[model samples]
Target: MEPLFRLEGVVVAEADGRRRIDGLSATIESGERLAVLGPSGAGKSTLLFLLNRLLDPTAGSIFFRGRPLQAYDPRELRRSVVLVPQRATAVSGTVADNVCLGRRIHRLPCPREAVAEMLAAFGLDTGLIDRDARALSGGELARVALARAVLLAPEVLLLDEATASLDPPSAEGVLRALFAGLSARGEGERTVVWVTHDWALARRLASRMWWLERGRLSRPPEGADEAGAEGETRGTAAGEGGARR
Candidate 1:
């Protein structure tokens, strides 16, 4: 079977000649859970943007399901490849409206029951459904954004520091609900590419891992201590204040 996404010598560079992503080449298979790990400014977020057509590479090619990524309409491509950005965003409306945004975009039915179920799954009280979206906290907004994307049932889900705002226990609960919802969709129906500095969370969620550094893909240092590496990545994440290229 053809891979869901394939990149060949992909390069994303700024106008001033700094490369955000350089010579990245990889295949994302269907149903694979991929964890992308990197220090601050490692281009992890840039890679996700490219995959969903939010940003195109300055060089090389990207193919999705045997077709060049650019060949597909940007809106159409985005419907299949959804991205939950590092910063949570909410439309100006009620919580239910935000949760049903994807379906509305696709012109699908926005069933009230579905919205309630998704919110509940994300550990949100259904009573918040009618509440103003603008009043949500950072963590609440993150979960809402996640629920919005998941409700779309996109073929691929791209997450960039998605759970960063939540405490560990809350993050874990959200992840559990996320996987359960995805699993209910049936095996091989959805793929997840998660960008995270939390190594332990990545281990729990991903089937494979990729590391990026200085705008290029690379292996971890030889015999790197897992626990120490996790701490280092977490510390860097904090120092950088979640800023990424």
Candidate 2:
């Protein structure tokens, strides 16, 4: 089967001749959990933007499901390949309005039950549904963003430091709920590409991991120690839980 995405000599250069991504060739398999790790300014966020066509590359080609990204309508492509950026953002309105923005955009019905369920799944209180979105805390905003993206049921989910604002325990809980939700949707139905600096979290969530540096990709160093001693076991357990779907 064809990979979900294929990049050939992809390059993204700024007007000043700075290359954010230089000759990046890669293949992202369908339904795979891919974790991209790198230092700050390694073009991690840029890569996600490229995937969903938020930005065009200066050179080379990117294919989504075997079709050139440029061939698809940007609006249509984004509905299937959703990206949640690191910063928490909310528009002027109630939480429900923000959470159901995608549905509204697609002219789909925004059922109250579905919205409530999504908020609950993300560890958010359904009561907040009527609250002003702009009044939310940073962590709450982050969870709200996540809930919004997940509710869209996108084919591919790109997360850029999505849970960075939450505390560790809260982050874990939210992620566990996320994985459960994805599993319930059915295996191989969604692909996740997460960009994070947390090695242990990456190992726990991703089936495959890659290192991006200086606009290039490479394998993570073998035998690199995880932050926590139980990281390996937790990773295994997470995979097992997902497989049970």
Candidate 3:
């Protein structure tokens, strides 16, 4: 199957004028669950930003479906490749209002029945649809974001620590629903690249892992001591007690 997204020699600079990502290149196959594990300040978030077109590379290029990303319109790029951020800041609106915001913005047709079903599938009460966005809890806000993103039917899904704030049960429920709904399309029609510091979560969801350290990419053995004593495999964060600079 053809790659859905390709990054070649992609580099990004930090606020202090430092090159955080130095010449990184990778191919993202359609419908593959790829986990990017890295320490704080390892450019993991920056990489996701680049993939979502929230941030452009200082150098190098990205291709979507064999076409250069630069050739595509930014608005269109976002419509096709959406990012569901970790922090849940609900847009000011009702539950159903927020859920269908994407479709409204893009002028896409959406079914009300489908919207209600998605809300229920995400463990949200249908009555909550009439409630204000700010009234929802962190987990509820997270579900709303996921539902909205999925409703857009994006070709590629970029999850940046998306489940970080949710309680264990809520997080697991959301993750299960995500994979069950999307992964059934096989490994060649959709794509998921989730960035997280949680190794256990990565192992549970990602089929392949890429480790990042100090702006460089590493494929350290899954359970190698190099990943530190997190006791979890794959992209678990190294210094959980503190953030990296």
Best of the candidates, lDDT = 1
lDDT of 3 at 225: 40
Q: Write down the RMSD of all candidates, one decimal each.
A: 6.4, 3.5, 6.5
What digit string (tens of lDDT, one per residue) describes model 1 on residues 1-245?
88899999999999999999999888888876777887899899999999999999999999999999989999888988999999998899999999999889999888899899999999999999999999999999999999999888888899999999999878878976886686675345678888988777666656667888877878656544264343123223311122111
Model 3 residue 124 lDDT? 86
Ranking by lDDT: 1, 2, 3
Superposed model 2: Cα runs more than 4 Å off: 185-188, 219-237, 240-245
TM-score of predicted model 1?
A: 0.89
Q: Model 2: per-residue lDDT, tens digit, 1-245?
A: 88899999999998999999999999988877777887788899999999999999999999999999999999999999999998989989999999998878988888888889989999889999999999999999998898888887788889998999988778868876776676565345678888877777766667767688778885444555343222122234345455223
> Compared with the true structure, what per-residue lDDT tens digits does model 3 show for residues 56-134?
8999999888888888898999987889986877778888888998889999876778779779878889888789989
TM-score per prediction, in order, is 0.89, 0.90, 0.85
Decide which is better by TM-score, 2 or 3.
2
Candidates 1 and 3 compared by TM-score, better number: 1
Better by lDDT, candidate 3 or 2: 2
By TM-score, highest first, what's the ranking?
2, 1, 3
TM-score of 3: 0.85
